[model samples]
Target: MMLTSAAQAIGLFIATNIDDIIVLSLFFARGAGRPGTTSRILAGQYLGFAGILAAAVLVSLGAGAFLPEAAIPYFGLIPLVLGLWAAWQAWRDDDDDDDDAKVAGKAVAVWTVAAVTFANGGDNIGVYVPVFLNVGPAATAAYCVVFLVLVAALVVAARFVATRPGIDEVLERWEHILFPVVLIGLGLVILYSGGAFGL
Candidate 1:
């Protein structure tokens, strides 16, 4: 049972965080050539992930006790709305200049990254709640620890990838379009998995 729980946790963590690599890579690329920026991005990622985990635990506990299983999935709507908003912003900023992009890049802060991470992870809660409910406290603790380690490793890998010479050019060229498209796709997947569209 312990092994099974651990495996499940690892799988869940990977599944939920795969997209984080892309997001983190973008952040790392933006922070490149700036001293102390990578550290700030890493810190923000950790902070954001912590928020997501905490929310999952709280919602899992609360919803397990009070909310119906069917209704719990509707939380996916949070990400859906956020994604739509992001897409709209991206569209509206289609004519943005390099100067604006530079300004936006300069404005990247730890808290800002944390907020983006947390908002981007809205779909995680929909998947985590049920998983958390099925596991024991000990297993949950193990899962959290493993998730933390994996998230750190992910940040490192993303940073490395982002710093690669050719990678930055590709990311920079399409990031505006790619980011919003990814968000929108993620939202739709969450809505479908959560059965939100059924109603």
Candidate 2:
């Protein structure tokens, strides 16, 4: 029974965090070799996921969700605005500097990645709220522990993938184009999934 609960928690965490791993990979790809960047990304991921779980636990504790469904989609604006800003910066600074310097722009912020992770977690809240409600407190605690452990593992795995030779080279080469497009595309996807634009 304990193993079953643990398995359920693992599945839930994995389902909600696949995109997070991708986002982390993007961050790692962009921030590779930069001092302090990895720590910032890892911290941001934890902080952001903590926020997601906190929101879920609090909302579930309230015995219901407080945020209206429509408002959930509006959360996409966070990444949307960040992406546009990144795009503008990239456009403005098409310089003669090396790729490392070029890609090093402002992605090192812990809060920035945290915000992106949280923004990306709107769906996570939706998914977790119901599970938290159904599974009771002990199970929820177990899930949270499993989720946090998996977070570290996920970060390591993503970083490893991003830093791999061929993969790292390609990611480094295309980070400028890839970065903003990914964030914007993620935002649009979030919005679209929520029917935010009626499309």
Candidate 3:
């Protein structure tokens, strides 16, 4: 059962972080010309993800003391709202070249990347909270271990993909549209699976 739970946690971590590949790829591409930037990006990603994990664990443990399970799932709204907001921003900036300037003008700071990562992981928190709540302490610890290791793997994969030729062009062209749509879809999945809609 412990192994099974750990496997399930690994699967969940991958599912929630699939989009990180794209986001991290973009960050890497932006920093491709800079030295030592990859390390910063990696650090930022880890910090952001750790923050999300910590938040989920704290909330799940705290709320479990008093909140009903049904009420807990409503946390899915966080990602849903963030998704809608991202979609709106994409629409507003559909014709703008500001994204290029934003990427080029500044060195991507660790904290900036961290903030983006955390903000983008609203869905992760929503999904993780319930999973953590349902598991035993040992299982939870196993999940955390699995998540940390996989997250490192995720960063390496994103970096490789980002550095590849031709991929950056495609990502740059479609990112604005793709990112928000994925977020919205992820949000819906979380809401539905969490029974937030009572459906």
On lDDT, the leading prediction is 2
lDDT of 1 by residue, 38-61 (tens): 789889989988987887787766
True lDDT of residue 180, candidate 1: 57
Candidate 3 yields a Cα-based lDDT of 0.72
Number of the top TM-score candidate: 2
lDDT of 3 by residue, 130-166 (tens): 7887886778888999898888899999988976779
Between candidates 1 and 2, name the one with more favorable TM-score: 2
For each candidate in turn, the TM-score is 0.69, 0.92, 0.66
Give each prediction's root-mean-square deviation over alpha carbons.
Answer: 4.1, 1.9, 5.1
lDDT (CA) per prediction: 0.71, 0.84, 0.72
lDDT leaderboard ranking: 2, 3, 1
Overlapping backbone residue pairs in candidate 2 total 0
Evaluate residue 1 in candidate 1 and report its C-alpha lDDT on the 0 to 100 scale: 75
Task: Residues 1-199, candidate 2: write the lDDT tens digits.
Answer: 8999999988988888887777788888777667887899989989998988888888888834467656778789989998898788878877756655755544578998999999999889889988999999998999999999998888898888888889888877777778889899999999989988775
**Model 2: how far residue 99 lies from native, Å:** 5.1
